[model samples]
Target: MDPKIKSLPTMAFPQISGIAALGFAFLIVLGNVFLVPAGLPHAGAETGEVIAFFTTSKDIVGIASMLTPLAWVLATLFGAGAVSVLWQSDRDRGEAWSLVGFGGLILQNGAFAAVIAIRLALASTTAHDSTATTELWALHDALFMLNGTFLTLALIGLSISGLRAGLIRQWHGRLGLLAAALLFSSATLAPLIMDQAGPLGLLGLIGWLMWVVWVGTYGITLIRGGAVPIESQSHATSSKP
Candidate 1:
């Protein structure tokens, strides 16, 4: 490393944020496997199936729902760190992608929280009113639509930014592009067919899985990149005055 680069301030914020985000993702997967009962139906499932799932998994689901907000908040922090790192690479041009990526993440997390909130509220019903349950489930799916859209934009924006900045590898960028394409296609085409379990839907699911991997790698890249030139540049500017 150049002496100037080596002399730049080092920060662990991005690394810590990355680890936290990964931990939160792990927690979600674990919650689904152990806390939530298996064979649960989806938001677009039949009324009886939906009720059955809630009946079986309400308490555990509620617990997970309660914890999700915190998880997303940590994700948001990591996302911001991602933006910071990208900004350092190309200040003027990177700004647009960084802002879009940050906004997308915030919206995605907020929508996720809203979906959980709606579900949690429905779960509180002692008696499973079929009408109320069905409506809430519909709302949950709708929220997921919005969440999915934001997620697609987030990955696309971040991937492109990271690609241009050389912060992430080319293969990683391509993976993100593929994931984004799958999600966008699903978001637009699947609803037309009204097939939640159709090809597009499966694509979306695969995309989501890819998203987890993409984010994990993205966070790690950000962590490994470290905060140097940004801090150092600002310091140099301040000292000049």
Candidate 2:
């Protein structure tokens, strides 16, 4: 490592925040996989079915639904942490991209929180109004469109900033780009092709997992006292493919 790199200021707060974000994201995945039903029906599910599901899975659903919003909130903080690190590094170079990424991430979290809140409301309610449930579920699905699009925006901006600012490795930047592409593809093509079934949402999920790993690895590097300095930015940018 360059001497200048070793002299740079440590970013311990953002590093810790990033690690926390990773932990929260893992909780979300675990909740989804083990707590929520795999074969749950979408919008237009009968009132009886909805009630039955809520009645049967209420405990786990309540816990998982609560975890969902908490995880998303952590995601928003993760975005902020990225912004903090990059912005502190070079105000002029990383500010715009970091802000853009942060904004997109906030929007994505809001969208996800909305969906989770709706699910929680549905699960908690004792009223068996099929039409109301259907309408809410439809709204939930519609809001889900924001998830992939905003996530793509966040990834693109962060990856570009990371590449240009030398905050992360070239391979990591490329991984972010790939994840963003997958999210964008899923957001655009899934709705058009999958419709109500929305099987293509899996693409977004996979991309999200890829993104988690990329960000988590970067966070771990930072926590391990990796070098990131202004003088080394150019050399870091040109290091590898």
Best by TM-score: 1
Q: Considering every candidate listed, which one attains the maximal lDDT?
A: 1
* Candidate 2 local Cα displacement, residue 111, angstroms: 1.0
- Clashing pairs for model 1 are none
Residues 1-241, model 2: lDDT tens digits: 9999999987577776677667766876777775545435444345576667766676777777767767776777777777777764445533477777888878887778888787788778886587787677667766665477888888888888767777788898899889999888877875563355456667777897887787677666555654456665555445535
State the lDDT of candidate 1 residue by residue for 121-187, as single tens digits. Answer: 7667779989988888877776776467888888888888777666678899999889888877766
Model 1, runs deviating above 4 Å: 1-11, 35-37, 193-196, 226-241
Q: Hey, what RMSD does candidate 2 come out at?
A: 6.5
Q: After superposition, how far is residue 219 of candidate 1 from its true place, in Å?
A: 1.8
* Location of the lowest summed lDDT over 10 successive residues in candidate 2: 36-45
Error of 2 at 63 (Å): 0.5
For candidate 2, what is the lDDT? 0.71
241 in model 1: Cα distance from truth in Å?
A: 25
- The true-versus-predicted C-alpha distance at residue 224 of model 2, in Å, is 2.2
